[model samples]
Target chain A: MSQIVCDSSSIISLSENCLLNLLPRFKVDFVVPRSVEKELVDKPLRVDEFEFKALRLREAINEGIIQVKDVPGVHKRAEQILAEANSLFTPRIKILHEGEAECMAMLELTDVNTLLVDERTTRLIIEDIIALGNFIQSRASFKLRMDREKAMALQERFSDVTVLRSTELIAVAYEKGLLNNLGDGHLLHASLYALKYSGCAITKGEIKEYLQLLK
Target chain B: MKKEFVEKLKKAFLHGDARGLKEISNESAEQAVLSRDKEMVLISLVSYALYKMLTKPHYHYAPGWSDFVKEVVSHLELCIKDPRAIQEALGKRLIEDIAKMDKLHGRFMGDLIERARVKQASRAYAMGLSLDSAAELTGADRFRLYAYIGRTRIHEEIPARSVRDRYERAKEVLG
Candidate 1:
């Protein structure tokens, strides 16, 4: 059987769309860390529609169609990782965001092969490779510096320029009657990709297009 | 989008006004039926999550954050119960739909502890999230907070002494 773990974003999105009923269609075991559960339960809703859907999803969970799991050893693994992460280098070449560090811990601890992540910074940090380069003299003395110009350039050129397209996302919304108008569908789709790829240095031009569509 | 709407939602969440919270929650359910737009859906989701975080206090606090977070949460609650009531009636169906979409964000949510905002939010969320309530909201199994922290690696050390010291304090709550 294929198994999957869910993140809060997916959970909220699924819930809001009222498509959570479709979980059985995929027959996947949706697991979430205890922290995520806590995270959503405490968070206040900004949209009336989202809150209502969240409440319903909450009820569905109570009904037991969707099973939420807290993987064991997650905490121990996180602690170990934190310790290792903190001691990674002499002064530490890079600092991991709290979520990134936690995610790295989760990836290490869990045996799952795929993760449905949307954060841009996490993806870059995970994919980018950088190291110290030759020293350069600027007026006084030569100093060794971490040269990530290549990686930075790559990100600037391609990271945000590309987009992840999912026919399922658009199709599903249509099927559920979630797309009320042309503007609604276009803007909503744009926002989904926008927030997901926000860390990629995407151009303002694209964002403006999306915002305009919504208007 | 509207300033008045945002203000109203903000008020409801910060005050833990269950009446307003419930009203908005209903509206979100109704709207999900007609508007299939994912972005609007997400904006709505953020609001709901924020409200839940604020309305309840079930964990430890770092002093100043409680008020600040609560204030933000209140704003979200009003959005859910806007006067329009676009999606309030659908309720459970809406949630089920969202649950299905949640798979898309599973990786992101699973990796939240690695993010700074999520880390801080998780800490704040825990304070307001009872184990039972949290489980109900995110479809998460019952697990001790410490265990989740361990999984996130927040329990681990940092290169900076100051950062490490603060992490230690957050860890104490789990212990």
Candidate 2:
């Protein structure tokens, strides 16, 4: 019953795929942290290609399709979560970034129920700690399960934060008839595959399965 | 020893002239299409493609591409001095490129980079490298590599597994 809170990755995914315009039609207000907005709109502007995408994101904001808000007290919590999350995986190698924590902070301070993210590490961090623990244990390189107390704290602190990729967002929008004009009768398939080729990390077989469900 | 020829080839690539290399390869294609000369020709083509990739002004500073170009240029320098150094040099360059590709390309550049990977992979396959080897070099996702690898000149077979099969494999290992 809460609004959709997204990170830079989801927006970047959609923007890279030329699907940013379709975002407004998702029928829910989209909120990103100020840091995430900086990532979306500023840091990438140095590159010619991303500068164009950043402009589109700026337009989405100016058009009122997206909202950028700074969540209070979220940074502290997010930093804590990031430390715990990184420790769960390979040490000395950071697995999540500040913007992910910002998204979580938004979730914590606001009523957002879902996090729209695209990166695997951040998604794994927020998915299910127990599953992640089992995964690390099964690997020879990672012999220890994540520290129990920290893992439990993370599990409890952000357990309500569900994550969805841009792929699912498009799928849901297609199902909801939000992307009806995207193409012909095969628009759904076309759109799904377009997302894949544009770096959604979705598989063709998975797209087929979802297409079946859409029908 | 073809040192000067290899150096010129390296220059043509680092200088970002695809057409120049293409014309050069076309000339050599017939002369060495089947002889020991083919090895040099294949190496030249690979260098051409890699040059077109790393020298493109658009994504010049990307971490992944930058790392690749750095490794490649060092290898190319070695390769020019000793044309016999192609396999070890370029092979190492390719593996580093794959490992660094998460920094691969910024958003708008995905399409361009993917195109470069496919073109690069085509040359690698024609040179008789395996899919894994090509993937390591091109820095393309294995899934995308598998999808683009059909009809490659390499002709080596890979498992025709579904995405579910990959997922099952993941579960088997992680469980």
Candidate 3:
């Protein structure tokens, strides 16, 4: 069975939309780092607003639908990635957080080449550093200094990692006929938008195109 | 925060200058984007709440309005005196106080703060933080943030590979 490393963003999105069942249906191992489990289950469990969602995720983990894995050297690797990625722009804003860095580290140290993340920043950092840098500079009021070499190095490290969002996962499920019972005509369309509103980083244009292709 | 900025913020609070507070909030948000300082982000958020409290007629006439404003002003005075030690706590306390006010009065105050958070989170996303990261920093709901973000051109500004290609790639990998 193949394994895909999960991040907190995707898990939270999936959980919020009641899509955690899709994990076991995939027949692939869905693993999260320890830190991600804290974000998904531990921390949220304490807050009243998110307590129910946290319980759902915790139940999924308890039932063995989602596995929690701790890989060696992940912390050290995460720190290194944080240092390099954080320093990529002058005036050094912390673009990546500890949870994201841990996810990247888990992807690097393990054999899992596929990363299931819903956030655009990590996906952009891996897939297109130049574009990410340009986007950052465009958003900032002050002129930003880009460290090209650092961006290049980080990109090279994550070059082979395949990034996918919760939206795609739901789309894949739709294509596989798992969503047939949810209503046929508008199921795919509604599901895609549901994921988008639930924190998947897919664009409206992208959803429109998906409807054209998949419908 | 610089002493000058704190002083200005205090002056805005003292004078009930909603417009000035809004401007400070914008300036602080920009600084947060550049510096990635959580304190700056908090300042932006608190300033925005203050702006709303001052400008919104409902909040002004609400019960305990005077006490709340006076308390916030006192907090600002402390912030001016020792920003490093007091700013983050003041920001958090303001949010908590607003929550309490909402409970005591009605849901109106809570709605205002939620809107403020969503607005600030949108600004953060526009200023280049990922949707999730921005939401994390601002305590905004990701669902609401994405909904707000979808209506803007931020997605267009940073185009990604086509969804079809990415979908095909996802199919290949997951299969």
lDDT of 1 at A206: 37
- lDDT per residue for candidate 3 within B61-83, as digits (tens), equals 99899898777777777777787
Q: Give the interface RMSD of each candidate.
A: 21.7, 13.9, 2.4
TM-score of each: 0.35, 0.55, 0.90
Superposed model 3: Cα runs more than 4 Å off: B14-16, B36-38, B82-85, B88-99, B106-119, B135-156
TM-score of 3: 0.90
**Comparing 2 and 3 by TM-score, which wins?**
3
Cα-based lDDT at residue A97, candidate 3: 73
Encode model 3's per-residue lDDT on A1-215: one tens digit a residue. 88999887788778877888888888578999898888777876776666887788899999988899999999999999989888899888768777888989998998998899887788889999898999889778788988988899999999989899988888899999988877757988888877776667778888888899886
Q: Every model's Cα RMSD, please?
A: 20.4, 13.7, 2.7
Maximum-lDDT candidate: 3
Choose the strongest candidate by DockQ.
3
Residue A61, candidate 2: Cα error in Å is 1.6
lDDT of 2 by residue, A1-215 (tens): 13678876567667766687766665567788887778677765665545776788898888876788776788897787667665654332233557776787778788776777644445555655565455444432323445767777776877766567677777666766777766557877877666555544455566787667667
Candidate 1 lDDT for residue B52: 46
Candidate 1: Cα lDDT at A160: 21
Query: What's model 1's lDDT at B37?
Result: 30
Superior by lDDT: candidate 1 or candidate 3: 3
Off by over 4 Å in 2: A90-92, A133-145, B1-175
DockQ of 3: 0.50
Model 2: lDDT equals: 0.57
